[model samples]
Target: MKKLTILFLAMVIFSCNNQPDKGASDNNSEIASQGKIPKTEKEVGSNTTINDYSQVETEKAVEPDTIKTNDNQDINYQPADNNNTNQFEDNFIGFASFYMQFDKPKQTFILKADEDKTITCKEGTKLTVNENSFITSSGDSVTGDIEIRVKEYYKISDILLANLSTTSNRDILETGGMIYIEAFSNGEECELKKGATIEIAFPAKDKKDDMQLFSGNWESDKVNWILKETIPVDSEENAGFTFVEKMPEFPGGQQKLMDYLSKNIKYPTRAKESGIQGTVYITFIVNEDGNTEDIRVVRGVDSSLNQAAISAIEQMPKWTPGKQGGEYVKVNMNLPIRFSLGGEDFSTNNIDYAKEFEKQVNDSNLSNTEMLEISHYIFSTSKLGWINCDRFFRDNSPKVDFLVNIGTSKQVDIKIVFNTINSILTGSTSGGKYIFDNVPTGHSVTLVALKYEKDQYYLAIKKTKITREEEQVLDFEPVTMARLKAEMEKLNRI
Candidate 1:
């Protein structure tokens, strides 16, 4: 009996000795919750450091509300609350969720923090990050693995779905493209280190030489871009002269130049169908070797016409080189091409191309992608977040305020989309009304309003031309999620 008792005691002692320490188990549980584990004194030969979470105040997680459409499908819905002090804030959040539903999934890439890496997005956007280029919000250097999330907006449809607009300080902007980029290290948001710039080659179908870099500034619920600097125009190495002793001439003189343009210019089918007719002024540099280089649109009316004019000029044969003191020199030249359904041709006799070019250059209305016709927009940016390749829209039309009466004080999201320009504006509530101030008169626009109430979705869409300070009442109708999506898709076509 004594031998058996001694054996049992020995077994109990061995089991207890092999078990993990209670303090170590608790430490592991804490580390697991915090997502990182610090080395213990025994492991690092120093005291263990652990963050305290007891004093931290965390927001209560709100459960997503659901609504059943006519199709009997449950969809996540968040209604606006009028009782909230910041109605715009709530409306903006709801609008963001609504638009994000139609957006494509963001592209994600991983990189080592200690290595230089280049990530190419599926849409051909290239991002080059240098070694040790990232830091935390607290300004600490980031290490280990870094995660990059990229969202590219190239088409008008993409921009609409993302709820982005091409506007700066209430002025209009023509966009080449836009991109949203963010980085993360150890599941925490990271930023670029000081003096660190990520080289970006944002692919654009219509590259404009004057397309400038704009960084988005988020205020309230909308994003407004702020101009940074101009994108450099790619050109040959030469100190070109605006004036020369003898100007560059087209091969075989002015009449032949007109004939070349008439034969080569093919009016764009879309432009013809839409009845878009206007003149597109093209500027180019004739080098010492008599080759036309750096062709750009200094003034344009429509994208189709601008592209057509640029294409014809790009195919022109070498010109007779200009002269300065009887020696060949580079000279700047501008040509105006007319697109008319009436088949009107260019008459060189009535036009002085050089003087007209000089006057247009002095005009505040400058070159922009409003009519750009290139394959790619290349620029470098040090700032992250949302970056836009854009130019200010020059509109001299009269401006007026537009108002919408929703008839109910309930939460609503409103957007005013310009039909012709790449611009969108959010409506602000004032005196029980949603107002869009300083909108240009005599322009076509679409008004969209969205509402959610009692597990039902309500929507209103109206298209009209703003002739003056206009007021329209919106009648809300219950719509299924599918119908709402279809209606939003139509806005992208405009």
Candidate 2:
């Protein structure tokens, strides 16, 4: 019997690499390596020593060429020049905003350290973010953008209002509307804090930049925050998943994550001694800041194993974070960590490929030889089918391919999903065709198509059976906003 050798291959775990790769681990190592950390200074109004974490590294940010003064005075603005302007107690601020329509009003907060100095917006700060096009369910076009209303500013000791307002008057700020808010700590660090006068500037968005990319240096006696408001945007009437144009990614992608886990994960000595070896299911929340938190074992074999899994997860680097409708949002994720010693039982409990293949032949009402012939035809002729088969055979394993034709000329993103299967593979098409390979032979699958335009996503879905290699063309209407809202509600219920 040909077991699923791909899944059962022994993974070689290595010792953790102590030397941090650039953009690999999240710490002050980058700043330290660049020699940007400032000299130690005594904390004002406190007895502690201010450390590197509080200093601003102005190594990557370019200061604005001109500073518009409130009194019509032309003030020269330059980045930290390491002169008198770079005062020991000075601070720098940076700002960037994106156009987004919030389904619900979103509340955001700007966190500040206790040692932060008072914020002073010398020249009345105001920024106009150009509106972007987004469509409503009623086939209405809308523009989304934010303007700084310096007039309505609110100030407190450690917090300040964002003073943001929408450009369009439409109440499209209901559930499912999109909006953009740049996370403060989401870019390159520069040590550019100069004199008593605090300077703030906004960087132009680059083509390859994410919606929330803001790279500048914020400096002070301690790192201070400018905006602070607890604005909350409800994506739906019920807790709903706002599908993102791009999903969160590990720093070096999934392969690096696997490598990191292999290197960092430790088999609990106590669990090994007790012969406890099973997969540990862990779930965590990846915050908008790309940091993982709330990590806990959902399904655990033993306490020692559970703690070991949690420790390994806690040591992981920050992710790139997820974005929905162009705005960064917190996403929940689940991962399974396997902990097995040698000589473990390899039973159908793991995965039964032959049984599934036989069931596929039975369900298709075809003989084993006939099904094999059909699979061969698909692998040899169908372009997508060939690609799917090639991927399956690359691992020296065979799996059923589920191809679905959306029957549309418009370019839409498709996600072929198997409801009950393991080792699922991903494939894409240039047009409306989608191929999902590596599914269990005798199962069912679902295909979800989403057309993202401007800041809105129009969706369509179809479900079908999976038996051997075959293509299923589907007739699906564009998902209405009402239906999408209902689906979001159902997801919340689950």
RMSD per prediction, one decimal?
A: 24.7, 26.8
What lDDT does the true structure give each of the candidates? 0.60, 0.34
Indicate the TM-score of model 2: 0.26
The count of backbone overlaps in candidate 2 is 30
Weakest 10 consecutive residues of candidate 2 by summed lDDT: 377-386
lDDT of 2 at 416: 41
- Cα displacement (angstroms), candidate 2, residue 7, comes to 8.4
Candidate 1, poorest ten consecutive residues by summed lDDT: 6-15
Residue 377 in model 1: lDDT: 47
Error of 2 at 361 (Å): 25
Where model 2 places Cα greater than 4 Å from the true spot, the runs are 1-243, 343-494
Candidate 1: where is the Cα deviation over 4 Å? 1-94, 97-104, 112-118, 138-145, 155-157, 230-374
Against the true structure, candidate 1 reaches a TM-score of 0.53
Model 1 per-residue lDDT tens digits across residues 69-135: 2243445544434455453332222444445445555566768888887666777676767789999
Quote each prediction's TM-score.
0.53, 0.26
